[model samples]
Target: MRRILVTGARGQLGSQLLRCAEDKGLQAAGVGSAELDITDRDAVDRWVEPDAVVINCAAYTAVDGAESDEAAARAVNEIGARNLAAACSRAGAGLIQVSTDYVFAGDRAGDAAVPYEADDPTGPRSVYGRTKLAGERAVHAELPSAQIVRTAWVYTGTAGGSSGAGADFVATMLRLERERDTVRVVDDQMGAPTYSVDLAAGLLELACTGGRGVTTLHATNAGSATRFDLARAVFAEVGADPERVQPCSSAEFAKPAPRPAYSVLSPRSWEAAGLTPLRPWWEALADALARLG
Candidate 1:
């Protein structure tokens, strides 16, 4: 049996991983930033035991905030990753680094583009993206055998989830549904919504199976959707008027960081590795909503 250690334990993904670990029969330990800051090399060294499977869920995910706080982002996303890689290498432990779709330059550029494959060239357009890309490079440099799984637009049904209340698009829309008459969401940017519960299962599968032939993978729920599409789905799921969720362009809702217009990542490499792809985004969303209640 593989001994598992999950960093970012308080986060949505981490919490879900903990909840699912028992079912998967994984010998697991989870720690949050307060318990084990990944940026601290000594702490990481102490935490990463020999022959352990380390799942790094810790990251600086504030896309807009990262623009003004690149140093803070780099500390957690890049340096933290480097520290984990180094510790894992020294201890002979396997590292699974959780990443995001932001690593790609999501510009649609006129015509429709294919979803990004695991080996596709990365060109991040935001500070958060650049730092995460740097983290990926740092991990690969330190441990070539490390597994990287990039996901997008994650939500959770678990109350007091690590990502925070209303942090995800689904939760935000639900809140707005109760507070406002209408919610205007961006329709330009596109990607899949991945529920943390579902994502946690996939991560565990990789760790338990040694992540064979899956050096780097895109592990989001199947299907593509925009913010508007997601907001409407949230409303529909809650028995609210879907029309209350209106579509708007990205320019109308300006932010500090630029998001990729098309960030739908492909799971070809994951499938090629003989692993089952995650369920459809909409199906997972419904399950998540049911669990939330």
Candidate 2:
């Protein structure tokens, strides 16, 4: 049996990954941050045993907050990653880490023009981005057979559950449409909003294909979406008023973290890995919203 150990098991992607592994007949156990403190190098040492593929899903996701708390962010994103890499190395297990698009600086031109490839020059604008990039670098350097999967705008199966990610954009929009007469979302920023369920399934599929080691790959929904368009889709999916969600520029609500204006990562890696494309955002959104209700 392929025993898979998923960290951040309580997280959005981690939760979905556990479920996917179960479906594929893999013995998967997810230990959340509460169960294992990855930043504590000894904790990681004790947690990882001699067998099983390790997937690191836990991350400090606050983009703006990371700007102010750089040290804490590094401790988690960078140091934590290395700890896991070292543990995986010692255990002789494959490492699968989930990363983000923030590693890229937002200076790329046009909305849908720049599709960040795996080998692109990483110019992270935010502290969170830099730390995550550092973590990726550390993982690759330490654990040779680790697979780093970078994704964006993830929505999980439990996105509407008591957990955090479930209460994210889709749930928020659904709530806003019900209570508020109108909701304004940023239109300038663009990304390939991925579904965590889809991403999790895809990750396992990639791993099951018989490859091991550290290779960077991107996985997300097929199409690009502005935050406004995503909000609109959510409203529509839940049978809410699409007009209630209005389009606004990111400049209107400036955030501390400089969000990438456009981060439409290419799905070329999926094809390269001989895996099928992930589900489109529109289709996944409808399924997710319907499941929510």
Candidate 3:
């Protein structure tokens, strides 16, 4: 049996990975941020042992906040990735890194949402994306065998009894639904809402392939969703009127971090790995709501 070291054990994906490890009979340990400061190279060097695969899930996930804290985000996302890769290389272990879909520029001029491929041009619109892309590069630099899996709009079934619907897409929707009677969500951006649990299962297969060099894989759910569509879905799950959710544009919800108007990652790598396609976002959302109930 191979030992697996999972960084950011308490994070969304890390938690899912932990559950999968138990279900799939894999030997794995997910460590929290308190135990492993991924930004510290020497600390990482001390922590990593020989012959253990490293899957880095630790990252600065504050998308809007990263705009003002690029330095800190890069330190953790880019520099820390390099640190992990170096440690893994020294120990002769493989590395699996998690990335994001924010790396795209969100050009949706055509009717079809651009299917971002592994070789597509990376035009990041936010600090978070830039740092994540740098981290992907860093992993390849130190350990050519590193695998990067990029996912987007990750959510779980049970967020401590809270509704997953609109939980992420429309934080304001949930607030307004509770406080007022109506709310508006941006309808411009489109992205796949990835179920962390499903994505985690796929990662294990990719890493165990033991393939050489860095491979960027997009492992999101099958369908894409607009913020408006996602909000309405949440309201439906809660037995609230969908009409209460209104449609708006990015201009109305101007945030510091520029959201990609279209950030849809394909599942070709998942197919290549012979893993079944992830369930539809709506299906996952329903399961998530059931878990909440």
RMSD of each: 1.4, 1.9, 2.8
lDDT of 2 by residue, 1-293 (tens): 55778898887778878888988887788899899888999999888877677889989987889989999899889999999999889887778888999999866774536788887888988899999999999998998678888899887534354356447676677667878899999988889888877888888876666343328888999898999999988877777778888889888998898898888898876668777798788998888777776
Model 1's alpha-carbon lDDT is: 0.89
Q: Rate the local accuracy (lDDT) of all candidates.
A: 0.89, 0.82, 0.80
Ordered list by TM-score, greatest first: 1, 2, 3
What C-alpha lDDT, on a 0 to 100 scale, does residue 180 get in candidate 3?
A: 68
**What digit string (tens of lDDT, one per residue) describes model 3 on residues 173-221?**
4556667688888899889987677788877766665533437777898
lDDT (Cα) of model 2: 0.82
Better of 1 and 2 by TM-score: 1
Q: Compute the lDDT of residue 217 as modeled in candidate 3.
A: 75
Record all residue pairs in model 1 with backbone atoms less than 3 Å apart, i.e. clashing. Answer: 11-162, 106-260, 106-261
Q: What are the models' TM-scores? A: 0.96, 0.94, 0.91
Stretches of candidate 3 exceeding 4 Å from the true structure: 157-167, 170-176, 209-214
Tens digit of per-residue lDDT, candidate 1, span 1-293: 87999998888888779889988777999999999999999988989999999999999988999999999999999999999999999999999999999999987555657789999889999999999999999999999999889999888743345556336667777778999999899999899999988899999998988767468999999999988999899999989999998999999989999988999999897887777799999999999898778
Question: What would you estimate as the lDDT of candidate 3?
Answer: 0.80
Displacement of the residue 189 alpha carbon in candidate 3, Å: 0.6
